[model samples]
Target chain A: MSEHDKNTRHLARMQRKKAVVDTKIESAKISKGLLLIHTGIGKGKSTAAFGLLARALGHGMQAVVVQFIKGRSDTGEEAFFKNAANLQWHVMGDGFTWETQNAENDLASARKAWDLVQACLQDETVNLLILDEFTYALKYGWLSIDEVVAALKNRPPMQHVVITGRAAPQALIDVADTVSEVNLLKHAFQAGVQAMPGVEW
Target chain B: MSEHDKNTRHLARMQRKKAVVDTKIESAKISKGLLLIHTGIGKGKSTAAFGLLARALGHGMQAVVVQFIKGRSDTGEEAFFKNAANLQWHVMGDGFTWETQNAENDLASARKAWDLVQACLQDETVNLLILDEFTYALKYGWLSIDEVVAALKNRPPMQHVVITGRAAPQALIDVADTVSEVNLLKHAFQAGVQAMPGVEW
Candidate 1:
């Protein structure tokens, strides 16, 4: 064979080897124990978290969602997934702490809700645990940061946890494996338009 | 009662009325320009979009999502939500023309895909439309960008569109009201662990 042909073949072989190595590297990811904190002043923090829950359910994975500071007004999420076998929905506490007053009382209820989530995490039956709007509790000093971190650390080795709300605590940020901040630049409502039925809710 | 007590009581009542008014304004928001596009080399774009479908369903609002290039994987989000009176799931296209070499054949299939979504955009029954991986087609020049934009502009007044893919056209970026770019900075896989079943699926 020719010298040029030999060099060309050698380069091709190297390229193929590199690609195989890359794929192998990608396929070996930890693939479990993901703790996601979606924060910042964006409107879609909760929306993004719920989007994750839906993904988990579609894959036949179990999801336990505990919604804090959002127990009223009947958010449509519950109405639709109420019957889905893989979904466990718990809405505890009044719409907001100010509404329920006694921040101390609200804190106890938040802790109780966390306890329910802990059972799912410990049971290893839940694939995804979404603590929707839990950041407010941390911000208001209703939930102990150490307790939250400890429970999360103790989650089933292969399970994932997603916490969504604005102003996430630094403590939560420190422990999260994946942190995404959705910053809201502009919103439709601010532009004098109302959220239409299907898209907004 | 003293005059001071009367003044304090009056101020408190006015504040309560103001609070009620603020909440009404907040609840009255209707999302029109809000759009969600999922573009990444991840396993969950369509899964995320479908989850949005369930959310819209819960709210009693209509949803119309056009699945592009994924007609074969049809595991049928259509079969799941199509029967619901308020849900409109449109799955168009026959897998993809990727392996097909002829330019004419590719364009022909693209045209077919466009036809289904184009009509749905006009129908008022459709509330939200998801263009799954449709961006890749346009990026590859199989579909015309002009035609796509025209369809988007001509859609129902309040209709929201969600486009997902790895590389969406520049025109799309210009037209999109909200765009989120998920940058893959690091992956745990490089270290070595296979994606866990329920977690990574």
Candidate 2:
């Protein structure tokens, strides 16, 4: 087809698409907050959550992050965002469950982190809350999934929550407004590539 | 089993894991660079790339971004990273191909963007290069896959490259050290949730 004809057809198609998209956008009127879940056996779940925190901060929104399974406070995200005045950071886990070596200790740490997250949920000023690696806590039975879901449902009306980890529970998935599963296609670490400092952490 | 016994078993398991992880880390001595590809129908491919850029910047590394299929500069990532001293940002595409309506114009824009990316690839100081939504250009025949692969192979030894989009070509996947497919388990947009600012820009 000639360029002009092609262009005219494309414009017509887009006009049809615009009508549909505009109607959808207009129909979506309930925008108080969102419960977003990122999970699966992939590498970018937590990284995606951190990106959202950056996005929220760009809009001058207050964000609070509570890490549930990672013990270290020196991740690349922490190195930069911990100093942000609008962010409240908490790294409360002892480590991975197998590394912690005690179920009671892991449970206690999870409980403590949840307490902090609850406070953040109650804070009217905190616009976004990130529960990093939280699904691990639920999967390991470190925290009650029912209680967590209840609390999330009862959070401030305008507070957005992002939960990131692997193997999210069906209950959590059901309650989420958006959910993404990042699947692993290939990994360098599997092929003898060590995790690089800035890239992995 | 008693709590102490369970704890002891956990410690032993972790010790074994530590030894294995340490040996793997030690064996991975060569660190030239990484060709990481994030492609799928899921939501976090570009977000994950942005997170990597943030991580690189946290380590004081320079990054250059060439957006291949998106034209809008009002994204949250652009709003934040464009001002960063270490980042060289380029929004080169004329928007999505369907939106642009002219294949010649789209091909010309893609070629221009590739030229800019080639310059960045040659620059030793650019530690990270992000080609956002680049796979579309190759898939649409706007650019040559062989030439893109050859240029990537010849990039600076220590410069990392991240390519993000859905349906990445097999050739690109073969050359990449890491590849992740972000599968769409569920999307809010499909459920009548409109894309919100700062969350889906």
Full-model lDDT for every candidate: 0.67, 0.84
Instruction: List runs of model 2 lying over 4 Å from the truth.
Output: A1-23
Judged by whole-model lDDT over C-alpha atoms, candidate 2 comes out at 0.84
Candidate 1, residue B74: the lDDT equals 28
Each model's iRMS: 6.7, 2.1
DockQ of 2: 0.54
| Residue A48 lDDT, candidate 2, scale 0-100 | 83
* Tens-digit lDDT string for candidate 2 (A1-201): 987887687678767776776687788766567888889887888888887877777777888889898998767778866677688888989887556657788889899998898888788888889999999889878789899999999989888899999999999999888889988888888787778766788
Q: What is the TM-score of chain B alone in each candidate?
A: 0.69, 0.97
lDDT of 1 by residue, A1-201 (tens): 785675466556656666776678566755566777767664555666666665566567788888888866456667777877878888876766445534456778888887787787797877888898889888877778898899889988888888878888888887776666655444555555565544455
Candidate of highest DockQ: 2
Give the Cα error of residue B7 in candidate 1, in Å: 21
Best by lDDT: 2
Query: How much of the real interface does each model capture, measured as fnat?
Result: 0.25, 0.46
Provide chain B's TM-score, model 2: 0.97
